[model samples]
Target: MPLVFSDQDLQTHNTLGLPARAAVATLDDESAIPDLCEALSSGRETDAPLFVLGGGSNLVVAARPRRRVLRVALRGIRLWRETTTHWFVEAAAGEPWHGFVDHCLSQGWPGLENLALIPGTVGAAPVQNIGAYGLELDQRLHSVVAWDLRAGRERELRADECGFAYRDSLFKRDGAGRWLIVRVRFALPKAWAPRLDYPDLRDYPGLGSPTGGAGEIPSPRSIFDAVCDIRRRKLPDPAVQGNAGSFFKNPVIDAGQADRLRHRYPDLKAYPQADGRVKLAAGWLIEQAGWKGRRLGPVGMHERQALVLVNHGGAQSADVLALARAVRADVQARFGVDLEQEPVVLD
Candidate 1:
């Protein structure tokens, strides 16, 4: 049986610095996953929740959980397979996402370069379908190894089976707490193509992207450096000021709805989706609602980026939720669109 710690303080584990606790266990490697699963199986009738915690970058623990918190500490990365078309790279759940991306880059894998500087573990990446610039984790994920908590069996889910959406996955939706991700495998193409379509990345060199043609292509390393630079400039370090990166998902509204808003505010940042919907920038809406840099008790919106909600020292879990609710309500009233939180709000 894996050693379980009682009443462990989890403030240090979570990036938001929220004080929380539960019966906790550390999964040190893939071998330990079965032992942990067996233990869970033995306690099948218990009403207590079991949560697999990764890097804790994308969660808001609003209260001390009445649950078992499994801290996934498994770590490993290697080239699993290579072919003429693609390179298969595998990483254990506990490996830091950025570190894994860096490792892939060092090994000459270029698919994850645009996703640099994302905070979380590799296992958590697919759950959130983490995306940045023009790339999403689902775009590179070949498959995932996860333990079915209820079924008491291990299973592998391919990319198509994962049900990925913008910042969402089966792990987050239907499988929430039911499947514990153990490891993830990514497919990096041998034929390299840097995605510089995102405005920040496209305009990085000051020279505009060529119209109707492939422009001066940058090396993967340069794109990685640009992404890192932009993220560092835009986002606040969690160590300096506790935050969960972007606080809200950009609202996807229909063409008519988007047009109405655009007419009202000509400066609205709206990106048209392939699905014919327009994704409105959450930060812009929040800033327009007048919440940026304004403190509400121990919480406030990040001045540099309105999308980020920060714990401005001595914040309680309720304080954070209250701030989020207030911001959401204001944005909804002002823009006629619902603002959905990006982070998982833990009970």
Candidate 2:
């Protein structure tokens, strides 16, 4: 049987630190999954909606959720296989993402270096298709093992079937409650090359240019360290200031619209996409709209990085939403680009 708790305090669960509560079931082992499924099907548990939780880094608790929360605590890591060009590694869903990344690098696997300091669990990575420093999880993903609630069995989903997009996946689009991830597999390259294409990584002190210039090329460990240092300098620690990193997705717009915006603002930061669309920097827009370091109630955008929304202290979910709405409205009015909130809201 899984350990269960009632009226669980959720202030510590989410990085945003919003006050909320819910009945929670902790699943720490895979063997208990069948029992959980049976309980859910037999209605032995309350008939409330179910919410699967990981590290709680990418969430906002809007209210006391009248739901049963399944907190995935499953954990393990192993070298699944090795090919001529790749090292296949597998990790349980509940493993800490950064720790897993670091483990891979420490074991001499190099592909996950660029993703080093991201918060959340392994299972959550595929859902958001998390990316940073020019590397996305989809590029290293091999497959995902999950339990299908509707079908009442386990299924292995290949990388192609995941439908990965910019910060999105099939697990996010169609597997809300239907698919509960159990484990994730990654195919890290053996012939590794440092990804220094992103501006920050390229300009990192002492790390030679991508074409090999001023200094020695960074190893996987150095790249991992650099990423960690960069993130620590830019984003606030959740333990000190409650925040969900990168509050909004960079808005993608057609080339014509981007051109018009660039004509008006000249300094607008836009990246051209393969599909002829342009991705605008949400942080740049938010800062330009004058929301940076500004506070509404007890919530505000981080002064250092405008993209992060932080709770000053004693904040509620309402305050967070109010600030988000105001920020979104202002950016839309000014740039005509809609800012979509990235964190999942629970109520």
Candidate with the greatest TM-score versus the true structure: 2
TM-score: model 1 vs. ground truth:
0.95
Error of 1 at 259 (Å): 1.1
Could you give candidate 2's per-residue lDDT for residues 1-347 as a string of tens digits?
66565778888889888888888878898888887777777778556767889999989886678667888999999999999999999999999999999999879888998998899999999999999999989999999999987667899999999899988898888845677999999999888888999999888887643444666667788788889999999999998999989999999999999999999999999999999999999999999999999999899999999999999999998899899999999999999999999888777
User: Candidate 1: where is the Cα deviation over 4 Å?
Assistant: 44-47, 206-216
Task: Tell me the deviation in Å of residue 195 in model 1.
Answer: 0.6
lDDT of each: 0.87, 0.89
TM-scores, each model vs. reference: 0.95, 0.96
Q: With candidate 2 superimposed using the best TM-score fit, by how many Å does residue 46's alpha carbon deviate from the native?
A: 5.2
Error of 2 at 258 (Å): 0.3
lDDT of 1 by residue, 98-158 (tens): 9998888888988899999999999999999999998888889999999897787889999
